[model samples]
Target: MPEKQRYTLPTKAGDQRQLGELTGAACATLVAEIAERHVGPVVLIAPDMQNALRLHDEIRQFTDQMVMNLADWETLPYDSFSPHQEIISSRLSTLYQLPSMQRGVLIVPVNTLMQRVCPHSYLHGHALVMKKGQRLSRDALRAQLDSAGYRHVDQVMEHGEYATRGALLDLFPMGSEQPYRLDFFDDEIDSLRLFDADTQRTLEEVEVINLLPAHEFPTDKAAIELFRSQWRDTFEVKRDAEHVYQQVSKGTLPAGIEYWQPLFFSEPLPPLFSYFPANTLVVNTGSLETSAERFQADTLARFENRGVDPMRPLLPPEALWLRVDELFSELKRWPRLQLKTDHLPEKAANTNLGFQKLPDLAIQAQQKAPLDALRKFLESFSGPVIFSVESEGRREALGELLARIKIAPKRILRLDEAQDAGRYLMIGAAEHGFIDTQRNLALICESDLLGERVARRRQDSRRTINPDTLIRNLAELHVGQPVVHLEHGVGRYAGMTTLEAGGIKGEYLMLTYANDAKLYVPVSSLHLISRYAGGAEENAPLHKLGGDAWSRAGKKRRKKYAMWRRNCWIFMRNGRQKRDLPLSTTASITSYSATASRLKRRPIRHRRLTPY
Candidate 1:
């Protein structure tokens, strides 16, 4: 790889410094520089979720250190539990990584930092790391799971649930992408494999798995008694309190109980700030004073509007969220750096940590002639230059563009090729690009040259495909909501209910149609049902049960889809034929003529064709 630009900033222990007017890439470079100088955990806070994610992506380009992103659970007024499983998993993973003392970077939004999390003691105690040959009785394993707040289910599908059958046990652990299947030979673990929840098939074998608690709160007997006692002390005898207390006493927790997790603990809950080491370097993208104030105001407004309802009791704002002043106080204990997108003032205060202004290295926007701009940039820059495109297609396009300008840039798959000083021009793929003027290198991105952002391709990761994955979470579904079935046009979703068929129990989705007709769809067929989203929910038309009209409409839609698929196949086949060129330069020109004639007879609309 090209040597990273080495720059120094005025940063000291127990000092707060403001970095002025650095772009996203510049900020990331600064963070990487600070990380190299310091030898501890680095926490970077952004103004919002979008900024946080963008900064994380930028920082990854500079360093290979363990970088974790903490996203907001959601912005809903009052949620018993966060609906986002990924965010919850990410938060837990970051917390788990923090205690290791391994150097890493954590990017998080200001709002996320304000929210309180489960105590560090609880998280450390509840986390389970099991390896092969870890001898433990089945009963003891069950008790461990119960203490970790996992619920026993008929089948292991979503996180926090487990199922046992004969000598086999399946568990969907928190912070895990897929559920694990343990084959026990009379309590001694025989084998373990990660399996797909939807197909109920093993994917791969593993020797060890680190499992985190599914929920934040404890669900054991003592935890229940503590919660009940706290609930009685907080609220007067009311219907909601009594109902929640009854459920907790019966060893079952109600939905949205996560909001009341603080009540379960006798001591005060801690914010994320408390978990960090004393030497951790805290970096703020913008003015922390401004962002924290806005976050606190927005949170207070949400709590004020929603905290008074008896039907949904909300945890007091002070208990669940930290004030701006309190957050600043906590941050003051660590060395803090503030990044701004504007120049610093002349007579600014807080000079304990001096300022180092980085040079402006923004790429000039391409005007009408992109080829001319590329040619000029290539000829003018003597140092190493890398052009980053988004995809293979863009790479080819850029190569063709450069070829027209008499420039033959070598296409390199890895950054190691650019380390050689002799190679000036190279092409590669990156999500975003920037120039490091200090290193005498420039990275021109496709977006900067073409003025069009490419859609990033998501990397495929192994995920547990449960029935819930096929549809919305059961908690999000409600009666009388409009739902659409592949066969049935549109109908109202009633609710989920259990039915027994052939002496085997299964859950099903109940849908209501016209004339009070009901259709019970097996949970396995969840992929066929979707929330009605054609138009306005109120204006959607419901179909009658067992109607011929629905079948006819479905057939017509299938026919159109099939035709579209055929067109896509033809386009792909033609493109492949073009790419399968002969290596010999003396190949017959007649073959090209024949291909051109065939193309003339069936003209290919390259622009209209979508990638397969």
Candidate 2:
């Protein structure tokens, strides 16, 4: 059997507890252990001196040694560094090639020190890499974790994650995956393992690494250079500026060379370098709390405050049901408006109490009451009204009530068709009360109550209105009139015929066009079908068959249809004006003042702060 490699050595049980106390100190101890095992002086690199100090202090206590060369490395000098990129590049070249005094290690958090390392090529132990086709390649699976980056305890949790492209892969594997291997090949596998998300490992067997500093990892050099230059202008005067000038003056800095270190490396060296060991214990502080209930409660409270009740009608059931019945009675004229119901009541029930036959529906207990206000409203208004129903049962019940009340229904329209009908009185469900046209308020009545119909028809200032009735009237499509086809260009619809296919029969329209060509279209394709813009009646006798004029007319109609689809009806109401609705004078003044205060106090740049 092959030997098993041990990644974590067994530490005394108490050692684990001691490690927990110091987040930074624990990391130092881990790095020291690895350095001792490797018999090399480790170099610890950090973004700034403060980070270096914290790490250094922890390591010093563990090793009881002052190997931190505070003077030689940290105190280097630099000058004439116009662009920060140039200075950084010069320094890294010196550090990477500079032979180790004892055991050198670089501690660079993130790619700041290494720059421009393609995330795709970064590999860490048990880290996941995603390839093309959104596939993941995971190594070193911990059954409990099974995936990297997912169960990690780090804040802004990242690392041990990999994604793949057609032939490329990206992995942010942390310490577990050292010098993550990169596989490149032509329909074959070529592997190169180097990089640690924590900067722990480096190229083990590669001949040369075209490594750039952690900061240059991004593909855009200009952007990185710009940022680095800006950062330098602000804070670069410290160790980095000093080190560059000293190296350039001494002629120790290399020209045109950028040192790139593996993520697995302990440290990134430039102006300063210190020691770090492999397998350093790094603990991230902060907890991520999951509270779904809090979010749900907050959202519920907001809706409740707005008077939105999901389980019940926006208005009381008694008020809503009564108004609905009064509206349905007025739409029973058209044949197409016949209400379809499962079963009819043995006799008409006084669904609307103390009402008989349509118009007398005005005879309610009290006209001013909220439940009868709509009936009073209908009687007082001089304009025509159209009521549409969506549900069959409601339509039928409403039809019976309307019949019992003796109110004439002008039109029953499908919600989609009626919105554009341009009638004076248009009543329908407001589509979840959001005032959208997608929903239809339908009125249907049963068979015994033949007085109620599914739809009605009425004349309007612009055109005749009745959704159900209009649909039935559309049945009389003429040969010369323009008709739209789902696929074929606009042509004159000659006539309708039933075609038998596979023992099934379907009705289709025969359309003859300008070229003397004919096309067959099925009725099921109604959405794509529509009528041309010519009036219901034209001045001259309609021409037979097809011509250029019809095609041009069809195109014009299609364009208009597209524009119509984009149009939406909007009702604007300011709640301040709504207070005029019979509110007490004293209460109105208080409400207005409160509203004014709220408006004044609100921040101009008000931002919604999401609850945690």
Candidate 3:
């Protein structure tokens, strides 16, 4: 047996303690324990979004407390587009819940926490509560939705979109999982149904839904006035030619409008720290000071890079983001703990509580017993062990694996059902496993037993609009990527450019074909373009423009496809069968070739003498 590794964790968290020697899922375990014992809200600020999400998922297994992950916009500081609808919905939902949350676990990335969010009252004020029998007017609701930045679409397929048709009102509220169809009878709502966007079928019946604003900023007349007034005050420009000023004045919400959210608000937007209670305990991993500094640097870089877009003037980065020192000052308001996976820094506190991660299962490739180490650990471990897999299928598979190795284990659901000296299987996810020496409990995660897992690709929440636009917009396409043009063959995307044809300027996609041939396709015809996927792009054949090779290849492809569609049949018109006889075969004196040769020898004497 190898020497047992040990980590020092405090039994009770100090006002400002530095936790050291914690790695992988053990960090989540410690945070969960802190949340379980602490009376106030526990905030864990991770260095990045992925780490914060992993910790959030893992911590849920350890404690029954509410674990909320407030993610970032996943966009640049001065991007031309907004975040996805689902991401926006999630952020708004978390912001709405944060103020009322007395005690729970809130996990956030350092950058997310650094940005200022809309105040609680802003959302609460604009929100509308609808029930089964509420009196409503379609026109009034439509006007309100428009003011709230909700698009009046023909169908409510995404968040912050609403549609009205006669007595039925459909709206997908921000911060909601599903779109809702409100069936109204005359002036009152008769029924409310949550629906599936793809199938357009009602999934469940709901009595009430809280309608929050689509954008973080307001788009109403008053808010727009406030924004324009503030813009004049801030920029000191009147009747500016900026596209943002012109559009916002007309109450049209433009892309990447989040940068100007502060101007729309009557009061100053509040930081994330303000949402938490006075006694909120903050647990942070990694160097937040450095992260903040790096964020500020990236913000400045973006600010500089976006200077070319004269139509959309950017407010300074200081207005949008909190500085490193300001972030640190906010951290000072809460009881802080710095988590580390390596050796403690010089002169740190001497807090101690032993928590050891499960040792790696060392198995040789040619070894006879691959499960030998795991069997031994299960047999020797004194505390109850829980085998956590990523899902139910994994749980059952792991159960079978254990059973086949002559280690029968009980199947359980929750951690509370664990028993001393027993091995159990459960559905849970943890990056790694750990042994709590103080609690006499051991958790053997999938990673611990089977090694690293292949993470599943995240599926997009939004449904595909159409095949023509499988890629929603040209923004999805990048330079140097291969794309297929409907009329032309495969070409490499160069970039977007404005070309004037017949005295009119228009946007077009620049595609480079063979021999540096360029084809400028109209932006409106993006439907005819798609991303190419012919494996190993460097090896892909690029056909020359205005050449017959592409047409010939297309014809051949179409022919093969047509043949395959008809049961992949092969037309063997000249093929011979077992029952058929050849015409020139000399069999039973009925050979046509033999007779013809004989007649040819007789030639002119009796020309047509070859007869039956």
Candidate 4:
């Protein structure tokens, strides 16, 4: 190690430094160390939601500090539908802790950090805390719930919903997973019991319960009036036809109205960073700046296209989100940070913890000695190896696999248990493994022992399919071939053509019907087309536009579907003890369709393969 390059964390309240080459799960370990040394909690700004969630699980193995993940809405920037109740609940719970969070880790995705959250005063002010022996006001509490954006329901099953019947009141708090059953003795103090949402049975007792606002923004009369006035001032449009304005006037939270979060408050909406304590440290990783640029470009495109629609107008991107420059300005405000720079090459520094990545163990399953490489490392390695599996089930499965080779490993829960040189089993969410030379320990995961698999990433955000989609592009078909259109029947395929319609240019499939009549269909509508395989493989007859033959073909398809469904019901009715049967599957339907296609001219024979 160099004289200046040390492994110690940032000591000051606000300091910006660089950390690099800290690959794989070592990032989580470093983050855990920072939180312990700093006076305030550490806020990790992950590149995406998947990366944030992975660190949230792995960091706990290193530190006992409270770890929480501030979840994203998982909806697009201007999506019409609101986020799920559970996601909102998780977010509110985490936000409530941020203000006075003495020490811990808060993982937030970069995209989520850009959006403006509810004002800090709004969340803390609206929150209601109740203790077991505290007196309860039935009528006042009911009115408070309604004003706080909670819905009155017949049964309390989801968060932000409450059900009341006389003395017994059931309410699912925004921060809690289960509904609480409160038994009130008139207006005096009573008991609070946690109950199951599904079975409606009491599970246990609780000393105290913290109740957060049902929605991020308040929906009280003052908030609504403020929103309506701000909407008029900002939009400067006719409000009579706008559904959002109408609903706000009536104190109704319309679906997808979360996009208009800025309008709900008379004061300036605060950025996500404002919710954190002033002295809190923020860390940056990966290509966050590039990702933010991509997100901004996408949002701008949506803004331009959505301008024409009067029913729901979009707020300026700057109003709802912070720009990349603004994010960096906030990042520099943190007292302790390890920010990754895109332009400059990293030098050896105090922040950098030199943890080498573990070498891959290519386990050949087919060979007699599949564990040869792993065995060699286990025997030669000087430090203890903590093998971290993604889940408890994977840890058990790994133990069973290693036992065949006579390598009995001891299972432990924490990193402190790996004291000496040996194999230990631990469950974590590490994507890759690393070895800390100074600590004399190495961390490995299931992917190291096994091999890589297709890791699932964030799915609900903006996903752009190139040139339409894989299903839309019929690149397998030659320029000249017979194709079947669900609505227009048989046509001769003539490849794809691009044209401008309504001032928007797009690709379309060019198909020619009988007598040289041509039809152009958008490439996006590929679900309406299929390969022609009805009468003969190569000699599919082209149906003329506005012809009877096309209508007859559709009728035949409907009958075949009906017949297949009826046959399935008949077989299941007289089954030989069919259990755990799937109601229906696309594969089964496709198999039946293929078999029926082979014998189109005759009655199809039923093949019995049990009821399921």
Candidate 5:
């Protein structure tokens, strides 16, 4: 391992510097080193979302400071729903923390950087804080939540929602994972506790809670007036706008109203670059020009083919998003560092105040016996060696493999644990691994040592909403749209209505079928319903209610799907078998073992097998 190299940045704040030919991990390490010496926020701009997320994880290994990701909202033209709540909450939280935190890292994609967001002043005004001993009337609190865009519900199950039951109030605040149960003793607060939504069990008590607004747009009277005026002036009268306008006038927030965020403010929303302080350091992982161009082209293509009805009326692209040229102009205001894996352009290199070359430390191919290769590599190097595997079982197996080769490597659970050791081999868990020759460190992941297998990144330990439930919101349903029931064939969706059966009251989705037959499905069974999606809604066929014909059609569909799946599996299996044949010879037997090990290390990418 080579000694870690340190380069000096230019003296002036606005000067640009280039760090060329560095891999993702190497660039992250350099950023971490620079962050250690700096005193303020560090912004790392990746070319795309995947790279932004990957670099965020890599940078986390180097510093304990807050590392935040500002993800793209991913709004497409005529999208029926707002961006995911998690994505919105993360962006707002980062914005709120940027001005206050002593040091932090913000990773953002170019698309997110170009998108317009609410001004810092607007967000600061909406943020609310509560303490255990704080005194507040229930009526006042409820009104405040409603004005801040939180929905009142009978039960709190998701973020941006609150429920009140007598003296107890349950609320899941934005920018937080769990909901808080606030027990109030009349006007004075009694206690505050965080509870699990699944079990309704209290986890722990907290003294205070800081809450960010549930929606990005303000819901105050003045803001609503602004939205109403702008919306009426921008487009001709349409059914969708009229319906939304009525809801706004009545002080009710309609679903997917976030699409109209630009109208909520009287002044134009600012680009993300406006939030950063003047002295804050900016690092571009690749060329911003290329990223901006790609985003512009993709957006234009999506807008042209969206096929949304004109009456529904989407905001023009310019009103909601920034132009590529404008984003590039904003990029010029920051003191910048450019990290490039490939050769830098002559014009950029000449204009940069200083240039530093980072060594390339990529392993092109692995040898036949990885364990033997590892032993030899360790003997030839005098720096730290970290072997990262995905699971505890694999970590234990790796330790045994090393023991079989008469080598004892230290077991490290965290990166901080490896700081004191030099010329040591440590095993830990990581997503992907690489060797940093500049830091004299080699991070050999299970995949790289064994071969590429299907590896799925470990999901965070949070409850995930079902995919079918996320496809479309119930509010987005129209009276005449086609819908599909898992057990029944396609039917035309009638309006939802309250129904009482067996002395129980519930909301049901009414579906009309052939011969004017009707089927009422309980709202609790929403997971069983899906919007008919393959073709135009008008072309969908209506099924007869209580007919065996629908069952027969379902059976045929299942059989066809099973046959297609079987053929795909057989093709993949035969291809793998043919590829394995080359490693069967005596000269390549060790390579075959390495390949098999690699397959085991790779995360399984295949979907779960189901009985047809």
Candidate 6:
């Protein structure tokens, strides 16, 4: 080595100044010092392709044909899902192999282009350093993440994502190989590593290397196999249903055929899919100043404008894919990102080409512990209370407890059952022989876990009830009292609103007979109706819908949700109707049917044989 020197460049106060605040002049000076000492091609690594391109382009000015970006080279594409070699050769080999006619400087984004790069091949085996604070349990870290201003970002990699399955905690962070695995020791972090998301096994260490945002080998064999196995069962059921449907249309199957056997149940399918696809995700790298600034501004805007929480936790890493053709094309113009060469093992190089779906790791949910804390929160409230929970088991337990504590048996209603039955089921098993005053207690239970896997269930019962039902239920004043609302179709009385609108007036609500419509009934209409002949819970304090209490409560809930949406931008899937159209038409069948019908028809004389 000859020598090395350090220098700092002054930032120019202009709009078009380079983002890094350095110019090509300074870069050329640095390259000259390195070139004089180096014997061969120089290598550069960048966070993104754009930076790689900039560095390569800048260096090219001094040494006419010196810099060459690997992304600019042409290579066969490989399917990322299947095993394939991505790295073609080292920077030295690439330069040595170049034709005599192609002599120049070599520049490449080391990580992005090293498709063949795997720690397994490099180090063979090296034990990663295991530190105590470094290994955090999903639940423990989630609390920290809550304070970190990170949540699920829809378009970015799952940065602060956590998920649990029984004892296993999966976290996919930016630049880590595989998602990090935090096996629990009684809800504590026992061990951690970048494990294969599919296999759930610790990735065999190739080399002790710094993690990257992009995954070289993200697919785990287990997740893929699980999907493949389940697909056949799904296809068979679909095929059978199609046959049955066609037969019924032809008048072969009876009208009650559908009632005999339903196509499939809804509860189990969502979790199966949830385990894999949601794991592999790519986060936006913020490669550009404008992009980074946009993200920051959005965060601030949400906090100030929407009252969003800034202390949410980090979401999981998202697996972003680069198409082979597009990858090659962009490299020619801007050679910065390291696009891996098709140097995968023979088996991998010849693999089929297509987009492989990877699990978005951002959705890993912390376990049931957090909800326990929330339950304790509701216990502190002594007034006419309204609480919300996620789990059905928790709801049932609460209902049982409230029945024993309160006197009015009719006032305690379990809303979960009402969701399935399409009506509110009031179970006021109060010990005081039905306190027929006002319907006071209202409980709302919500679970992110259930919502994660509820979409695939064929039954309507498992589907989330509309927010309106919860609102309308709060408007009710008494059990067995008939109440009507403009929005909700119709529902029996359940309870009154404990949700306040902060200090705003005219925001109180009464439970009504409707499906999931919690009517925000105004408090000014207290004198609109009389109690029913046999209504229970009638004597409790009548609340004016538009009172100050309603306003305070409503604002609080809004603030929490606004913060949540800002942090976790969970994208909702648009439902599509699956219609099976005949791939081929049969014109001959139509002609045959017409001719056969004509032949079968006989011209009957107007008078004689009709009497028979």
Best by lDDT: 4
Worst 10 residues of 4 by lDDT: 603-612
Most accurate candidate by TM-score? 1
All candidates in order of TM-score, best leading: 1, 5, 3, 4, 6, 2
Q: Write the per-residue lDDT of candidate 5 for residues 95-140, one digit (tens) a residue.
A: 8877676787888988888788888998889899999999989899
For candidate 3, give the lDDT: 0.71
Error of 4 at 601 (Å): 46
The CA lDDT at 124 in model 1 is 85
Per-residue lDDT over 94-127 for candidate 6, one digit per residue giving the tens place of the 0 to 100 score: 3223323223344443233323222221111211
Clashes of 3: 0
Give candidates' CA RMSD values in order: 8.9, 35.6, 18.5, 15.6, 6.9, 35.4
- The true-versus-predicted C-alpha distance at residue 49 of model 5, in Å, is 1.1
lDDT of 2 by residue, 1-612 (tens): 011221232222112111121221224444444444433444443434344444543344334333342211121111111212222333333333333334433333211221222222222222233232222233322221322112222211123334344443333333221324445454333454555433324345432223333222221233334433543443323344234323322323222112211111222222121111222222111110112223234434543453332211121222111122221231111111011112223332101111111222212211222124335535554433344332343445344444433564544332223343232212332111111111212111121112222222112212122222121123446667675543443557678777765444456677776556776665433333446544553432233344445466668988986665334111111332443323233233233222222221111110111111
lDDT of 5 at 189: 81
How accurate locally is residue 590 in candidate 4, as Cα lDDT from 0 to 100? 29
Which scores better on TM-score, 4 or 5? 5
> Candidate 4: deviation at residue 228, Å?
1.4
What is the lDDT for 369 in model 5?
A: 38
> Model 2 reaches what TM-score against the true structure?
0.16
Question: What tens digits encode model 4's per-residue C-alpha lDDT throughout 1-612?
Answer: 011324555545456567755767878877777767667888888888777777887788778889988988867788666776777898898888889988898998888998888888988899998888788788888999999999886666568988887788889999887789988888854889999865678878888888999998989988888898898887754557347888778777777788899888877678888888866777767777887888778778877877667888888888888888987787666754554422236544434455777776756443335567877777788888888765554566567666655767789877777887878888766667888766767887766665552122222332222211112225445566888776677888898888776544556789999999998976545545667666674678879987889898668998998898678556653341244333332223223333323321111111111110
Tell me the TM-score of model 5: 0.75
- Per-prediction backbone clash count: 3, 95, 0, 3, 6, 126
lDDT of 4: 0.72
